[model samples]
Target: MPPPPNYPASARRNGEEGVVLLSFLINQAGQVELSKVLQSSGSSALDEAALSALSQCRFTPATENGKAIAIRVTIPYVWRLNQ
Candidate 1:
């Protein structure tokens, strides 16, 4: 499972909440080779925090014809404050 993103203290203090859409390439080694923010959360701190956490993750490599292959994927990371 992908690790949860760390909530930035500044964002929490400001009650910032939004979804960050990220595009990344997962290589055959199951490592994140490249990543970028496709959509922002309206808060740089939250967006950055999401990116940093994602970089530390490892994923199962995609397979093609029984061989591991790299793939590009996009996903949304949601940030919300607990009531």
Candidate 2:
């Protein structure tokens, strides 16, 4: 999977950090569908970056009875500054 978004410079300078939770559907073809941010990281910049990262990734399609199926997944993105 692609690495999480790079920390926003402004956020880093301002000491902002938090987790962003998101909800989206993985389609039968292993493509993201209907992506949405379910929770914010308290910073719009961070949230957008997370979403952008997710958009660039392709998930493995779920399967049932030897057939590919869509699945709903929730992801949490955590951002923390190194000490």
- The C-alpha RMSD in Å for every predicted model, in order, reads 1.2, 1.5
Highest-scoring model, lDDT = 1
Measured with C-alpha atoms, the lDDT of residue 64 in candidate 1 is 99
Local accuracy of candidate 1 as per-residue lDDT tens digits, 1-83: 45887789999999999999999999998999789999999999999999999999999999999999999999999999983
Candidate that would win on TM-score: 1
Model 2 scores a C-alpha lDDT of 0.87
Candidate 2: C-alpha RMSD after superposition: 1.5
Query: How high is each candidate's TM-score?
Result: 0.95, 0.90
Q: Write one digit per residue (lDDT tens) for candidate 2, span 1-83.
A: 44777888989999989989988889999988888889999999889888888887888899999999999999898889883
The 10 consecutive residues of candidate 2 with the worst lDDT sum are 1-10
lDDT value, candidate 1, whole model: 0.91
Reference-based lDDT, each prediction: 0.91, 0.87
Q: What residue pairs clash in candidate 2, if any at all?
A: none
- Regions of candidate 1 where Cα sits further than 4 Å from its true position: none
